[model samples]
Target chain A: MTQPQSRIRRSFGDLSERALAFWLLVPAALLLGLVALYPVGRLLYTSLFRRRLTDETGNSPVFVGFQNFVQAFSDERFWTALWNTLLIVLVTVPGALVVGLLLALLANLPFRVKWPIRLGLLLPWALPLVFAGLIFRWFFDSQYGVINDVIVRLGGERLLWVTTPELLFWAICLSIIWKSSSFVALILLAGLQVIPKELYESAAVDGANRWQSFWRITLPLLIPAILVAAIFRTITAFQTFDIPFAMQNGGSSFETLAMYVRTMSIENLNFGYGSALAVLMFLISFVVTLVYLRYVRGADD
Target chain B: MKKLFWLLVAVLLASTALAQQTRLRVFVGGQQRPDVMRKIFDLYQSRNPGVRVDVEVGGATSDQQQQYLTTVLASRDPSIDVILIDVIRPAQYLASRWADTIDKYLPAASRQELLRRYLPAYSQANVINGQLVALPAFADAMFLYYRADLLEKYGFKPPTTWDEAIQQAQTILQREGNPNLNGIGFIGAPAEGTVCTFLLPIWAAGGDVTNAQGQFSLTVEQAQRALQFWVGLMDQKVSPPNMAEKPQDTIRSEMQAGRWVFGTLFAYAWNRFQNDADSQVKGKIGVVPLPAFAGGRQASCLGGWQWTVSDFSRNKAQAHRLVRFLSSPEVSKILAIEASNLPVFPALYRDADILKVNPWFGQALPVVQAARARPQHPRYAEISEAIRVTTNQVLARQKTPEQGAREIVTRLQAIYGGR
Candidate 1:
């Protein structure tokens, strides 16, 4: 055992620093390839075929090239699902950001007992997405829902929060904002904590007002954290499934891309088409991430 | 030395017992009452001591169960020996070879006898391409549930035609000036139940989504007229304005709360309406065959579960025995009396024990006999999605009846492509 251990140490010592670094990275690189790259590569490969799991003939997957992608382009349902997903991201990301910023500011206030406020901020984020969806689904029920009850008490006409497509869309967005804003706030709060207390003290000495300090100091210093939060939230919003599914079981008029993928791949057993749709979704997310990274770099400069 | 010897003997005996036992896993949906099924399994085990049966309960809803079973079967997993499937799934399962044909287990004569025992509609659903693919575990059909007291108070009989039903509902609503009370309730939500909602009117109009040749051949005019009838109900305020969002459970609860004079629901709701502690409509409920379109025939959408032996099961012979045992008339009667599951055997409907426990089942037999299965194509799921989604859109006022009808035809035509 001693001889083998000495030999291994000598071999590692023999390598140059750069070479040693590369050698050390081999295991991690292999793991990344297995966990991340393999599934994506398989998705791409499957997207190029015509494969139905239920085909009785037991025929092997036939090469269809880009036909699945072509079909998705012309498929009206596919376009509707894509539009729904984009609308969700566009609306919910900004909605969560603004709400999250306010929450972060409030929580950042000098309270003697900070843990309780932080814990309160965490409660919504910690709740399961499906649970949040179900709670809100009841809240929006047109007949016996609490929202309608309140409105009726206030002398307002009852609105159909779930039956109408526009209202259902807003209801889902509201739920998403409620669940995700806490996560954004927690991130933003961390960013706030890292800012030097002396900077704020010095700003106060210069006679800057509170609002001015928030705008000129806190907001500017919080960009990196905000960008990080936006990146996570935007990607998650693109993959919105549980909330919409629990609310309406992916109703046709309000279906997101992820839900459509599930309908095709799992429900219809049409793997090829579903994979193509999934690949398209991945490309959109990838491009958005690239743009955000570019913006982050620009902001740093 | 004697104690050590006995210990060795016990270990040897345990190994032999373990080796002798053959475990069979049966997958049933949550709605099937797996707890009750476990009792039946116990009986089977006692009869066949060498076989140890295990129960795996699946999702509550048909859609969820289908997704779970599809994933399991597609992988050709042998873990599930016997599968309980929705009534509409035999064709798809058989076509995919996920289910083993029953002919191998039962001879033609015995299979014919077995099929004859079941209701005709069930036999029609289970037998595909001249082969028996499954056995019905129970029977179900959509029924028009009404408030008996309310209908009597208004001096109206159960409406037999869609037109009469609407007219009676309107008059009742106008007379009973309760703002909270609605005329009728039915599922218009985008759920598996909506498929039946979409098909019910067209079927009542003597039209079908598929022709006898199993091709897409929906009559566009019939579909349009059927859809317009539903939209008219909303426009006339015979149904609630938010009908499009109500699912089967929601409709059931609303009806049970005495919010509606009439509702259309499945056979299972009878149990809840009568027995659930919170039910307000108890002792005042009446069920009838769903109303027909004028000049057309009455039709109910067939809904039930069936037992199938998994093709990948290692012990197919034992699985066949278990399925046959579970689907027999004797066991069917037990399920009917114990769980309120409608028996697949027509004779069981008249059985004194079952009728005593569920008197409404007497009315159910005729409705069940007249019930029709949804299209039996392998792509039935997609077909159902198209119809239900379009129906939801029409009910939600996103599309005109004509647009919805044409879209269904177009979508089905595309799906059937060159067939």
Candidate 2:
């Protein structure tokens, strides 16, 4: 009985030690809750209400369970916006990855001009997003646009780059590619640097050509980097609004999910619907993250 | 070296402190020319010493509002004292009590001066939820700008009705040939621009998108007729080849070059048109009211910004002072003369200086008088979105006008039902 009592006392002693460590971490834990968790929780709570702010004096936030969600789902514009967003992701994600990989490969080349080429390629990403958006808007302007001017001179009809929904979507994708490809390239370039060159030298000795070496060796090794780049690009593209919003003013076929949420929350002042739409966007982004975690993170493993 | 560094730091700190005293941040949109804003600020500061307004330009109004709201909601202290709101949004802000009411700062007589001097619609735009929330900073109304030279050369008078307009435009275009001229053009791209500039013509054709009660009053046949007419203009070879792709800015540029016979545009372009620095038809352009639809009245959309005080602002008195000063009759006249901003006062319509400097202003008075505001319901933004989608569907020929109209009605009913 004395031995059993001693053992119980020892167990209580260990529990207290761990409890002290956890208590020591409480400040940082509380900080995280304040900065991140609290806002998200608040957003979720706000989504449950109908928020109407009139003249700063008459803000009435009332509970309207699921009504906002119902409206968002039933609206065809919401569906069209969703469709447009998906189309953009499908077009932009693969295009960005391929271009980034190509840029990385060129940068990894032994040529003397590689450094200049790499810097030049990455210059677009270094520029501010808004400035880049502005430049692109000017580039795609139909009447005085350099793009249209060139097309017309080359014996092609002028294409409305910012106005038509179909053309507007592609124009937006072009801006995204210009701004984001360099970022992807930089990431992949880092990944390529870490890779041992001896593997490629050995493959060459075995009579494998450059294409074969790339597919067999570089691609497999680049997978981890490629996955990381895609996760970043996809997330950014999903929330993509600046380029489209700036270029087309979110009126043309270029209204992304982010733009829709903005119009609802800010323009329409329907915070409930805006919140609901934002939550749905969050869920989509969350699913995308999970997919990346499972497929890309799993592949890395 | 240490002493020198200290001296440098002292100088920097002194300068920054001095700068802070005069610095005032003013936020504007992406489309607003930064250089023009700088000039305006310089002019404002030259008159008002020791006060410098810093411009914080953001994206379009929607994006700017997102940034503005997030800032206001996040800051414990009200950082933004004066806000420039779209004319449509003052009501929402006034309703939310986000803006301070202008009652105390400007008494009844001064306020009445504004109502009497500016156009009724312009004055009314700022009266959101019965509180005067903002002063009109700039006014933009749709005006029919025709090729005066073309009409005079071809012996064709300005058409009074939509059919007459189309017939006259066709005659000019057929003779002018494809490369030299297109009959008419517009902003038909699927954006706010499309809805703003293009929808007026449709509404003027005696069609309604939605009623004030938020019911969709657009008939399937009427909706189809409107779409068909716009597309038919292209098919009948009246408008440019890529009618659906052009923005209003492009259409304006083409019209300025005398490449297009006529176009409808915002009145702000008058300054550019009269300057002749870049225009081919600088002296040959004329402004008039948009053609009326058969058995229907001409409609023009009202566009501009209104000023509102933040409810969260601690300096309500100062904010009120700013609004009143900005809207004062004398200041309104100065802005109209110097900045070419339209006077918001109904009585300012007869201002001699306004007529002397801006002949276009006199021509636009009738258009502004007949102008109607967009559906003033809280769901106007949503209504705009619905209109954009349906218009695109029609333009793309993906959905018939009847089908698009049905879709719009169903969608609007859902929005109303949810509310």
Q: Which candidate tops DockQ?
A: 1
True contacts kept of each: 0.63, 0.51
All DockQ scores = 0.58, 0.30
lDDT by residue (B129-196, candidate 2, tens digit) is: 56677777666677778889888878988877878878889887777666678787766755565666
Error of 2 at B43 (Å): 9.7
Tell how far residue B127 is off in model 1, in angstroms. Answer: 2.0
Q: Interface-residue RMSD per candidate?
A: 2.1, 4.5
Best by lDDT: 1
Deviation of model 2 at B91, angstroms: 1.9
TM-score against native, each model:
0.94, 0.80
What is the alpha-carbon lDDT for the whole of candidate 2?
0.73
Point out where model 1 deviates above 4 Å. A1-27, A57-59, A291-301
